[model samples]
Target: MTALTLAAAQTLSIAGDVPANIQRHLTFMRAAAEQGVQLLVFPELSLTGYEPALAAELAIAPEDAVLSPLREMARELRLTAVVGMPVRLAPEVGVLIGALVLGADGSLAVYTKQHLHPGEEAAFIAGQGGEALEWGDDRIALAVCADFSHSSHPRNAAESGANIYAACVLISEGGYAADTALLQAYAAEHRMIVLMANHGGPTGGWTCAGQSAIWDTNGLIAAASGIGEALVIAHREGGRWTGRQVEI
Candidate 1:
C-alpha cells in the first residue's frame, strides 16, 4: 500500500456557540497541518454541538456566517476536513444533519445524513442522498452516527470503490465500547480503512464519549483517543501500519 498519514480530532462543541466551536476545531486542524497530515476528521455536530432542539432555533443555511472561519482554516491548513453541523435549507424550512467537506483548495461538498434515529425523525429532514465521494487518490466515504450502524452504509461505499470510510459520530458515554468494536468489525469485513471522530464533554442535555478512533483495512487498529480533546495520527504503508499518541 502507498504510505498515507491520516489524522482524527476529537472536539467539544458547546451548544449554539458557533465561533467558539469553530475555533476549537481549527486548533486541531492547524496542529494536524503542522504535522503534515493528509486529512483531518472532526466530531459530528462539532460546529454547532449536538443539541437538536437548539439547532431548530439557531440553524444556519449552508452559506451562513458560521462557515467563514472553517473555510479559511481548511485552505490555510492545506488539509481536507469533514465537520458536521445542522444546515437550514431555508428560513421557513426544516434543517438537516449535514457533513460539510472542505478541501485544501477551499472547495466544499455537503453530505447530509440520510438515516435518522428514532426521535430524530421529528426534528430533521432526511437528505435526498447517496454514497460518499472519491477525493483525489483517496476513495473517501462518510456517515454520521446512526448511518454507520446499518450495513448498507459501509457496504455501498465499499462496493462503490471507496477505500476509506470516515464517520462523524456523536456517541453517548454509555455506548462507546460496543459501537467502536462494531465499527472495527465493519471496516475489516469491508476491507476498507475506517476513521471516526466523536464529540466529547458535556453539551446540551447529554454527555458524549470521546473515543475517536482509526482502523486500517487489514483489521488493524491504528490510533484511538482517550476521553478528552485529542489528536490521533496513523500511517499506512505496504500493508503495514503504525500509530502513536501525539499532542496537537
Candidate 2:
C-alpha cells in the first residue's frame, strides 16, 4: 500500500467573515499540499468563528457557490480538505454545524454534527452524520466538537471499520485537558488513529486552546502544536507512523 499523510489545520477565524477565512484556508491548503498531505481537517466553524448567534443568517446549502474557490483549490492541490461551516439543508430544516469535505477529485461531501453542546440548541439542531470517507485501504470518520464527546459516536465509527477518527473542534482552555484525554482514550480503545483540529485563538467568546494534535492507534502522540496557527501532520508508511508540526 502507498503512504498516507493527514494533517490538522489549526486556525484563527474572523467572526462572520467567510471571505477572509476562505483566504486563510487556501493558505493552509497550499502549505499542506507542499508537504504532500492527502487529507487536511480544519477546526469547527472555521469559516465563521463558531458564531452561533449569526449562524441562522450565515447558513448556506452544501452546494453553495461561495465555496467554489475552496473546492477549486482542493482539486488543484489534489488534497482533500474538511472545512467547518453552518449548513441549512432546506428552509424548514434548522441550521446545522457542518463539516464539508472537498475532495481532491472536486467532489463534495457533507457531515453534520450529530450531537450538540449545551446551549447550542438555541441556534442549531442535531443532524444525521454523513458517511465515512473511503480512501483506498482507509476509512475516515468525521466528528464535530460535541459529537466526539458521545462515546457511542467513536464506537460506531470503529464498529463500521473506520480506522481514522478526525474531529474538528473549538475547545476552550477550561475543557482542553478532559477533551484530549477522551480523544486519546478513544484512539487506544478503538485502535483508530485520532486527529483533532482546534482553533488557534479565541472564537465565539472562548479562549481556544490550540495545540491541535494527532495520535497513533496506541494513543501515543504523533504530533502536536502549541497555541497558534499550525499544521500537525501524521504520515504512515511501511506500516509505521511518524509525525511533525509546521507553524504557518
Candidate 3:
C-alpha cells in the first residue's frame, strides 16, 4: 500500500446526544483533515456516549440519513473516517454497537462488535463477521470494543490478510493496563499494526481512560494519549511507521 496516515480521536461524548456529538465529530474531522490524516477512528458509541439504555431508541440503520454529512466530509477531504454508534440489526432484534466506516470514495460499511462484554449482551447483539477496508495497498480490519479481547478477533483479521487492526472502545482507567497488554500482544502475535480509540470523558456513569494509542508490529506503543481530548497519529512512510500524539 502507499504510505498511510492514521489517527485515533479521543473526544468526549454526551449521553444519548447525537446532534451535539455529531458536531464534535465534525470539529475533529475538520482538524484531522487539516493535519492530512487519511484515516480517523472514533471511540465506541461515540455518537450517543455509550448509553446502552438509549441504544434501542437511538439505533440508526446502516444508511441512515443522519450520517450523510460524515460521508460528505470523507469524500470532500479524501479521508476515511469511522464513527461508533448503535445500529439496527433486525426489526425486533437488539441493536449492535457498530463502527460506521465512511470512505473517501463514498463507500460505506458497518462492522459491529462480535464479542459482547459481560454486561453488554443485554443492550446489544453480537455481529457475525468483521469488515475490511482497502486503501492503496493497506488492508484494514475494523472492530469495536470487546472484540479485541478475544484471540479469534485478531486471528480472523490476520487470516483475512489484514495489515492493520483498529478497534474503538470506551476503556476505563481501572482496566487500561490489562487491556493495553492484550492489544500489544495481538499486534505482536498477529504481525499487524494495532490502533485503539477511547473516550476522553465520562459516559454511562463510567469515566474512560482516554489513552487512545497505536501499537507497532513489534508490540510496542508508538503513540499514546493522556486523560483528555487527544489524537494519536501514526504514519507509515518508506515501509516504516512513526507515531505521535496531539493533546488539547
Best by TM-score: 2
Better of 1 and 3 by TM-score: 3
Evaluate model 1: give its TM-score.
0.92
Candidate 1's residue-wise lDDT over 163-245, tens digit each? 88888888888888788888898778988888888875766667777767888756546555556777777777776767765
lDDT of 2 at 163: 94
My TM-score estimates for the predictions, one after another, are: 0.92, 0.98, 0.96
**Candidate 2, residues 1-248: lDDT per residue as tens digits?**
56999999999999999999999999999999999999999999999999999999999999999999999999999999999999999989999999999999999999999999999999999989999999999999999999999999999999999999999998899999999999999999999999999999999999999999898767655555468899999999997888989989
Evaluate residue 68 in candidate 3 and report its C-alpha lDDT on the 0 to 100 scale: 88
Candidate with the larger lDDT of 1 and 2:
2
What TM-score number comes out for model 3?
0.96
Candidate 3: worst-modelled 10 consecutive residues by lDDT: 217-226
Each model's RMSD to truth, in Å?
1.9, 0.9, 1.3
lDDT of 3 by residue, 24-123 (tens): 8988888888877999999999999989999999999989999988889889999889999999866777799889998899998888888899988888
Off by over 4 Å in 1: none
